[model samples]
Target: MIKTSIQSSASEIKSAREDFFYEQPGSLPGTLSIEEDAPPPVIVLIDYNETHATRKQVSTPEECIPYLDSKSVSWVDVQGLGNEDILQRLGNVFKLHPLLLEDVVNVPQRPKVEDHENQLVIIARMVIPKEHKIGFYSEQVGFVLGKNYLLTVQEEPEHDCFETVRQRIRQNKGTLRKQQADYLLYTLLDSIIDGFFPVLEDYGEVIEDLEEEVVSKPTRKTLEKIYRVRRDLLTLRRAIWPQRDAINSLIRDGSTQISESVRIYLRDCYDHAVQVLDMVETYRELAAGLMDVYLSAVSNRMNEIMKLLTVISSIFIPLTFIAGVYGMNFNTERSPWNMPELNWYWGYPLCLMAMGAIAALLVVFFWRRGWFENYSTIADDTNNKNYGSKINLLWRRSRR
Candidate 1:
């Protein structure tokens, strides 16, 4: 186990060194690590005013330099972190802090908030819904907000929640155009936070369904599903909990770049994060309870089956032994003294009557104990006010 642990840790270190790196603490703040596999940069420039908005996909990050100093609130979006040199040039173009560049290039530093002179670099985690499952595609989002512009660098050129923000800016749909770069950052963060609701809601419904399944007809699959849900909730909790703290810290630690109004929006964002945590924790505990219920239900079922088989054997075993003894011919004709009861006129009738009475008594005993019903139909008896019928079912089925 220790060796396995060592191997896993070594693999993780190798991945880290190979994948991405942020600046060492207090080193040049905007430094970049050019990973060997880093891809060419994809830049998107979105510059907008209260009356109009324009967007463009640029091949080079340097193309965005002219608009950064403009009065319009410009959003320079860089997607993919494959090319280190281009990312560095992009950072220099925006006058991004060395540490900020490092944070962006690192792909996934923890979701955090930091101030770099005139720029506020906010690192956040975003998750896109998985197409085939309940889990999400996690991405690191680095936001560099300045007085006149906001630069966001994403890990890849894939899924993002920025479309809504883009639409709002383009259509002049809401207060987005009236606000500054900080508000735009808030919009994107809020979109990412909102995305979790759908995933969490899926888990919520699954958990509710499991509640019935565990108590009614739990199988090994039910147990496995409960465990997986718990495990995934742990993953989500780990993700959202820190993001919540990050937002709260940002609110508490004021930045000159973030307007007072935008700070209010950030507080709202923090509240949403809290709500996410609450739902995650609630689902986790509920899933745990279902697991316990499943274990108890299975054990109860086994015990019931055993009881039924025991009853059948107990009744039939003695009766069969008596019949077997009577079936034996003890040379009664040769010696009536040896088998006087056999010669009695009503001997056979009396013996048969006695056996019938014993069988009847056993039937009455099983009935009174309510141990002659099918256990497999427990789920059908969900609306039952009492469990007696289900127990009887279990016994009857076991005897069969």
Candidate 2:
């Protein structure tokens, strides 16, 4: 039974290690594919300068053209990529290159940065922890930055991690209004990088809880939780690892679109990415360690069960032998050589008393050998503190 359980756990871990998503093999470059059920695109424009800021929902791609070339910094946010016609029109409005449009449309491209002659393209993944939940919502966010305007594309419009940045911009809480389009880009990227912390905190809390569960009462559910935590951490690592490199490239590579000041801010964002990756790796290692501890705990529990059964069977062996001997019919009336005790009046009671004495002596012998003491403490303080009651119950049963 224990062997079967261990094998099942091993298989589950193996299955959980599979990749989340992958591009179709041999697919052509610059191929645009959209999900059949994807929502239509919605365009929102936020144009701001140092003194004033205005936000409007643009119904058409051409509606954003007047603000795109103005002295004020313009932000064109297009949420959703379901409509190819609208997306192509958007590419025309922003003068986006064909390859860049393809990257923006692809739902799960790897995080990267591409510097064009007049624009900087950034592909980033953003994750937001679900409200009052254990998992996260992940989406791809694309950016196209020109001289005085920034174009942002998102896979979906339902959830985003940019609300705080939006609030800061609306309230004019900081120098966001004073900075250029690059600064706005930095602020959004910083928010996306900061978003990882909350999700990591959630995973950290889960790992701590699983540590206790794995040691004390590791059921199939506990094993599932451990595997899930590891899988989520793996997903996080994939998302953040390339993002760190992208930020590093933004810092090191000379891009005219990103100012020196913005590069300095990008350095800070890079640090946060690195920190998030470190936490992910740490949590993954801890989760793996917990799996090992769980297996060992289960094995120990099985050994204790087998040991108790062995002791019980050993005590019964001599009693069974005595009963068998007494049950054998003896011809005491025909020959004196046969068992004489069978004719004795006290034979039946003596046999019963001897069997009882033998059984008691075996129990005492086992007790003296410290078998009971060892059984009582099979679940140690560090490993199975929550199992004390179970151990006590088993001890009482063995005594009876």
Q: Kindly give the stretch of ten consecutive residues in candidate 1 with the minimal lDDT sum.
A: 386-395
lDDT of 2 by residue, 207-294 (tens): 7778677766789898778777877887788889999999999999869999998899888888778777877787788878888888
Best by TM-score: 2
Q: Model 1: how far is 239 from its true place, Å?
A: 1.2
Q: Work out the TM-score per prediction.
A: 0.79, 0.87
Instruction: Give the Å error, residue 189, model 2.
Output: 1.2
What is the lDDT of every predicted structure here? Answer: 0.77, 0.83
Residue 229, model 1, lDDT: 79
